[model samples]
Target: MSEVEKRYLAAKERYAKIGVDTDEALKKLQEVKISMHCWQGDDVKGFLNPDGELTGGIMATGNYPGAAHTPEQLRSDLEKAFAMIPGKHKVNLHAIYVDTDEKVDLNTIEPKHFSKWVDWAKEQGLGLDFNPTFFSHPMFKDNYTLASPDKEVRDFWIEHGKRSRKIAEYFGKELGQTCINNFWMPDGMKDNPIDRLSPRKRLMEALDEIFEEKLDENYTQEAVESKLFGLGAEAYTVGSHEFYMGYGLTRDKLICLDAGHFHPTEFISNKLSSLALFSKGVMLHVSRPVRWDSDHVVLMDDELTEIGRELVRNDLLPITNIGLDFFDATINRIAAWVVGTRNTQKALLKAFLEPTDDLKKIELENDFTTRMVLTEELKDFPFGDIWNQFCELNGVPVGLDWLKEVREYEKNVLLNR
Candidate 1:
C-alpha cells in the first residue's frame, strides 16, 4: 500500500477504537459541498486550465454589461458555461437586476426567461446561490442599511430591499429554490463611526416581510387544522457585526460564517460551533486571510486549516455549501475555483479524519475548559501533513516540491525576521 493508504488505515483503526466506523467517516468527509459565485462574463475555458496546476485567469470587479445579446441568448451562453463546470462545483449566479439602474433591481430578464434560466441550471445539474449587493443600483450609493440617519439614503435602502425582496419572492415561488441572501454591508466607519444600526434593522424588517409574503398558508379540511406558513430567508451575515443584531432576528435567519470575514482577534471555530448550536444550517465561504482584507485565496495557510477542521469535527454539521471567494486578475476564474474547491476539501478531509473522540466531545461541551484543552492540544498539530493527506486522497498530482516552493515564497515575504 502507498504511504497515504497506510496512514489512512492506521487513522481508521484509531477511529474504530473510538467507536467511529472509518467507512462511514470517509463517506461523511466526502459529503462536503463546494460552490462559487458566477460573474457576468465567466470564461469557462479560462477557469479550467489545460495544465494540471490550479491557476488560471484574473479577477475584475464592477458592472460589465451582459454580452450584447437578448436575454435568451445570454441564458443559452450561461447554460453552455454551466455545463462545462465539473458536476461537483456549485455555481452562484450574481446579481440579477430588474431595472437599467445597476444599483437595485430584480433580474432584468422577463419572467418566462428567468424561469427558463432556473430550469436550465437544474438541467445542467447545478445548484444556485446569490450575494445581494447595494452597488447594483444608482440610488444605493449611501448603502442598504435602511435606517441610515440621512432620510433620502434610508428611503433608498428600504426601497431597494422592497424591490429586491419581490425578486427573491419570484424566484422562490417559481424556481422552488431558496435564496441565500448574503448581506455584506459596505457601510463601515469612515473617520467617525456611523450609527447605522437602524438601517440594518430596517433591512431585517424588509426580509421578514419577504419571508411572510412568500410562504404558504395551509388549511386542513378535518374539523380544525389551520396553519399559516411563510417562505423562509437564509439570512447570512458576517461575525463582525454580530453585536448590532441580536439573536432574535438572526435566530430565524440562517447564520453563515465566512472563515476570512472574521477579525484576527475573533475565535472562528467557536463562532462556527455557536452558529451550529442554534440549529440553523451552516454555510461557509472558505478563504485565507491577509490582515483586514478577505483575501479569498484558497486554503494554503496552516492556521486556517486547523480552525476549519475543528469546526467540522466538533459541530457534526455537514458543510452545506463551500464557496471560494478569491479575486486575482491573472488566474482563470474556473481554475481559481478548482484550487479553492480542492483545497477546502483537503482541509475538511484532514479535520474529518482526526483521531480523537475526546476532542470532538470537548468541542460539543462548548465550555471554557474544553476550549482551553483544544487550544493546547492542537497547538503542535502538523497542518501541512493534513494538506498532503488531502492531496493524496483526492489524487492531486502536484507533489511536495510545489509546496516547498510555496513555503520558500512565504518565508521570503512573511518571515524575513
Candidate 2:
C-alpha cells in the first residue's frame, strides 16, 4: 500500500477504537460544499471598478502581486485555487463582479451580466452563490443605501437587491443547486448616532419591499448579514445582531453569521444552535479576526474547530450553509484561497472524526471526567494522516506538496501580471 493508504489505515483503526468510523466521517465531509468567496482572489475589487477605492469600511490590505484585474483572470485564479482544494465547492460572487461588456449599473444588473460565470460554473461542475455589492458605489451616499432617509438612495438599493435575487435564482436553476444570495450593508455612523431606531426601521421597510416578490425557495435562499462595527462606522451599526436575528426570525430568512463581524469575545459557534431553533436556516461567513474586524486568512484555530464541532455535534450541518469571507492581499492570493479553504475543510474533518455520540452519552451520564479525557485525547489524534489521505483520495496534492505548485504558479502566472 502507499504511504497515504498505510497512514489512513492506521488512523482509521485508532479512531474506530473510540467508536468513530473515519470512513463514514470522510464520506460525509466529501459531500459538504464550502462556498469559496471570489473576492479574495481580486481583493474585493470587483470587475465593476478594478481601481476604485473600497468604501463601506471595507479594506483589502496589501499590494499582493498578480491580483486579478479582469473576469478571465479571476476565473483562472479561481480554477487554480480549486485544483488545490479537495472536494467540489461553490464559488461565491458579488454583484460587482458581473462579467459583461454591456454598460449596466447595480440598479440595472440582470442575470445576463453573470451568464459567463454560470457557463464557467457549469463547465467546472460547481455551484454558485451571490452577494449584492451594496457598498463602494456613489449611490451609497452618507454611508447608507437601504436605510438612507433619501428615498432615491433607498430605491436604488432596493432595485439592486431585487435584481440580485433574480440573478441568484438563475444561478440555482442553471447549476442545479440553491444559490445563497446574502446581503450585507455598511450603513452606519462614524460617530454615535442619536437616532438608531429610525435607520433600523427604514432598513426593515426597505428589506420588506425588496422581498415582497416571493421566488421559489428551491432556486434561491436569501440571507441578511449583520456587522458589529466597521472602519468609519465604529460608533453604531444599523444591522446589529439583535436586529438581523429578529428580522430573520420574523421573515423566515436565513441569517448569515460572519465570524469577523462580531466582537472578539463573542463566538458565532455558540449562536448556531439558538439560530437553528428559530430561523429557517443559517449561513456562515467563516473568517479570522485578529483584534478588530481585520479579515485575516482563516487558520485551523481553536474557535474554528469549535464552530465545526458545533455544526457536527448538534446536527446543524443540514440546516447551515458554509462560506469563506476573508481577504489577505499580503501573500499570494491563490495560496490564501488554498490555505483558508483547506484549513476549513480540516476543521470539519476533525469534528466529523469525533466520537460525538460517545461524548454526549458520557456527559449525559455525568461522566464528566471521561468526556473531558476523550476530548483532550482527540487533540493528539492522527488528524494529519486523515487529511493527507483525503487529499490523495480527491487527487489533490498532499500536504505542502500543493505549496510547491503555488510557488511555481506565482513565478510563472502571478509574476507576469
Candidate 3:
C-alpha cells in the first residue's frame, strides 16, 4: 500500500479504539463545502470600478503584483485556487464583481450582468454566494447606507440590496444550491452620536422596504451582518450584533456572524449555539483578526478549532452556511486562498475525528477527570496523517506539495502579469 493508505489505516485503527470512525469523519467532511471569497484574489477591488479607492474602513495592505484586473482573470485565479483546495466548494462574490461592459452602477445591476459567472460556475460544478457592495462607493458618503439621512442615498442602496437578492436567486436556481446574500455596510460615526436610535430605526425601515418582495427560500436566503466598529466609524455602528440578532429573529432572516467583527474577547463559536435556538439558520464569515478588524488570513488556531467543534458536536452544519472573509495582498493571493480554506477544512476534520459522544457521556456522568484527560490526549493523535489521507483522496496535492504548485503557477502566470 501507499504511504498515505498505510498511515490512514493505522490512524483509523487508533481512532476506532476511542469510538471514532476515520472513514465516517472523512465522508462527512467531504460534504462540508466552504464558500471561498473572491475578493482575496484581487484585494477587494472588484471589476465594477477597479480604479476606485477602497473606503469605509476597508484596506488591503501590500503591493502584491498580479492582482486580477478583469472578470476573466479573477475567475481564472479562482479556478487555480479551487484546484488545490480539497473537496468541491462555492465562490462568494460581491455585487461589485459584476461582469459586464455596459455602464451600470450598483443601483442598476441585474442578473444578466452576472450571466458569465453563472455559466462558469455550471462548468466547474461549483455553487455561488453573494454580497451587496455597500462600501467603497461614492454613495457611501458620510459613512451610511440603508441608514443614511438622505433619502436618495438610502433608496439607492435599498435598490442595490433588492437587485443583489435577485442575483443570488439566479445563482441558486441555475446551480441547484441555495445562495446566501449577506448585507453589511460601514454605516456608523467616528465620534459618539447623541442619538443612535434614529439611524438604526431608519436602517430597519429601509431593510423592511428592501425585503418587501418575497423570493423563493429554496433558491435564495438573505442574511444581515453586523459590525462592532470601523476605521471612520469607531464610536458607534448602526448594525450592532444586538441589532441584527433582534432583527434577524423577528424578520426571519439568517444572521451573519463574522469572526473579525467582534471584540477581542468575543468568540463566534460561543454565539452559534445560542443563536441556533431562535434563528432558523446562520451564516459564518471565518477570518482572523489580529486586533480590531484587521482581516488577517485565517489560522488553524484555538478559535477556529473551537468553531469547528461547535459545528460538529452540536450538529449545526446543516443550519450554518460557511464562507471565508479576508483580504491579504501581502503574500501570494492564491496561497492565501489555499491556506485559509485548507485550514478551515482541517479544523472541521479535527472536530469530526473527536469522540464527542464519549466525551459528552463522561461529562454528563461528572467524570471531569476522564473528560479533561481524553480531550487533551486526543490533541496529540495522528491528525496530520488523516489530513494527508483526505487530501490524497480528494485528488489534491498532499501537505506542502500544494505550495510548490502554487509557486510554479506564480512563476509562470503571476509573474507575467
Error of 1 at 175 (Å): 6.6
Error of 1 at 271 (Å): 0.7
The collision pairs in model 2 are: none
**Model 2 TM:** 0.99
Identify the superior model by TM-score, candidate 1 or candidate 3. Answer: 3
The C-alpha RMSD in Å for every predicted model, in order, reads: 11.2, 0.7, 0.6
The global C-alpha lDDT for each of the candidates, from Candidate 1 onward, is: 0.45, 0.94, 0.94
Winner by lDDT between candidate 3 and candidate 1:
3
Instruction: Please give, for residues 303-343, the per-residue lDDT of candidate 2 as tens digits.
Output: 99999999999999999999999999999999999999999
What are the models' TM-scores? Answer: 0.62, 0.99, 0.99
Tens digits of per-residue lDDT for model 3, 84-187 = 99899999999999899999999999999999999999999999999999998999979998999999999999999999999999999999999999999889
Give, for candidate 1, the lowest lDDT window spanning 10 residues: 219-228
